[model samples]
Target: MFADGLFILFTVFAVVGAAGLVLFKHPMNGAMSFVVTLIALAGLYALLNAKLIFAIQLIVYAGAIMSLIIFIIMFLNIQEEDLPAEEGRFKYLIGGVIVVAPVGMLLTKAVNSLPGSEATIAGAGFGGVKEVGVKLFTEWLLPFEIVSILLLVSLVGAVVLAGKRGTNK
Candidate 1:
């Protein structure tokens, strides 16, 4: 009963935070909402017994990523003018459908599936930190490196966006 309650609470927090991120006019508030969503997701991960994922979600997203975002926002001195206005016309309805479609499809498919859900996810190769480390370093190493490279590119993009341009004079 307590778990169920916590689940509901966290899920509400997650949804509301996501909505706030999209609906908020301010970039800083959106970032803060994203943080709330990430933290709630981390809580969900912990509840599911995926301790490593919980830690990673918190450490990577809430800690490192949010810190980076806050730093960038502070450095850039974001104001009302810097933030983009929300798109026009039935955006909420459109956004609701966009978010619901894949999720509803996935849920429908899962409800129909006989093989996947019955198989215990907890026991399966969710393993732990050591197993995860081995796979991340060995099997997924190339993809991991590629992702890092992409992140580096994004970092460069952010730098270019924030930095003052050279004068033509």
Candidate 2:
């Protein structure tokens, strides 16, 4: 019962946070909402007994990633005039809903059509840090390295762009 309640609560938090992330006008507010969502996801991971995932979700996503985003926002010192004015926002939103609704329905239908069964208990070492580390370093090694390099390149690009903008101004 407690687990079920926690699941419901965290799921609500995640959904509401995601909505806030999308709907908030200010970038800071959106980033905060994303942090909330990430934290809720960590809670869900904890509930599922994925302790390593829970820790990673909190530390890597909510802590490191959010800090980076907030740092960038603060460094940029964005003002109201910096944002582009949106015209026909309501019309665009309605059009987006029209486009997304059918896709959402189809995905829902596909999920519902899947064979439903009770989840079996995970064996020893499942979701453990050691197993995860081994898999990440072995099977997923190339993709993992590629992702790290991409992140590094993106970070450098962002710094260069910010520097250019500062110099231009």
Candidate 3:
């Protein structure tokens, strides 16, 4: 009962966080909302006994990635005057709603039509840290290393671009 309640609470938090992330005008506010979403997702993972995923969500995404983003934002020293003024923001929002609503309804309908599973419980060692570690280091190793390299390249590129911009000024 308590777990179910927490699950619902976390779900609500996740949805609200996601909405806030998209709706907030300020980039910092959006980033903070994204952090909230990540944390809520970690809670959901915990509820499902996915401890490894929960930890990675918290440490890697919420902690390291968000910190890096915030640092870049600060380093850029963006001001309100630097942002381009938007015309008819309301019209854009309405258009977004129009495009999203039908897609949302279609997804809901498709999910509802899927056959229900009989298993209520996860099988033994499901989402266990050891199993996940083994799989990550073995089968998923190439993609994992590729992603790391990509992130490193992106970081270096950001630094180089920022340096060039600073020197140009």
Candidate 4:
């Protein structure tokens, strides 16, 4: 019962954070909201007994990634005048909701169709760092390496673009 209550609380936090992320006009506010969502997701991972994922979520996403995002936002120093007028934003939001409503209903139906069972604790060593590391290094090595390379390339590209912008100024 306690776990279920915590889950509900975390879920609500995540949803509210996500909404704030989308609804907030300022980039800094949106980024802060995303951090809240990330932390809530980490809590959900903890509830699921995914210790490795939970730690990674907090350390990598909520900590490192959010810091980087906030730093970039600060570096950009966006002003109100820099923002584009959003006269049609409400129309876009309503259209987006209309498009997504059917997909949300489908997801709800699919989840309801699943067989209900009592929650079971995972066996010992489940979600352990060693276990995950072994699997990630062995079975998922290629994809992992590919992702690392992609991230590196993107980082380099961002640096180059930022340098260009600085030079132009």
Candidate number with greatest lDDT? 4
- lDDT per residue for candidate 1 within 73-140, as digits (tens), equals 88899878776655663577587889999999999998887565532458655747887889899999
* Tens-digit per-residue lDDT, 51-119, candidate 4: 999999999999998999999889999998887788788889989999999999999999999999778
> Largest TM-score belongs to which candidate?
4
Candidate 2 residue lDDT tens string, 1-169: 7889999999999999998887777788989998899999999998887879999999999999899899989899988888667667678778988999999999999999999867578777878899889999999999999999999999999889767866747
Worst 10 residues of 4 by lDDT: 160-169
Q: Flag the better candidate by lDDT, 1 or 4.
A: 4
Q: After superposition, which runs of candidate 4 have C-alpha atoms over 4 Å from their true positions? A: 165-169
The TM-scores of all predictions, comma-separated, are 0.69, 0.83, 0.84, 0.90
- Write down the TM-score for model 1: 0.69
lDDT of 3 by residue, 124-147 (tens): 887889989899999999999999
Q: Which stretches of candidate 2 lie over 4 Å from their true place?
A: 155-160, 164-169
Model 4 TM-score on a 0 to 1 scale? 0.90
How many residue pairs clash in all the candidates, one count each? 0, 0, 0, 0
Every model's Cα RMSD, please? Answer: 4.0, 2.6, 2.5, 2.1
> Which of 1 and 2 is ahead in TM-score?
2
* 2 against 4, candidate with superior TM-score: 4
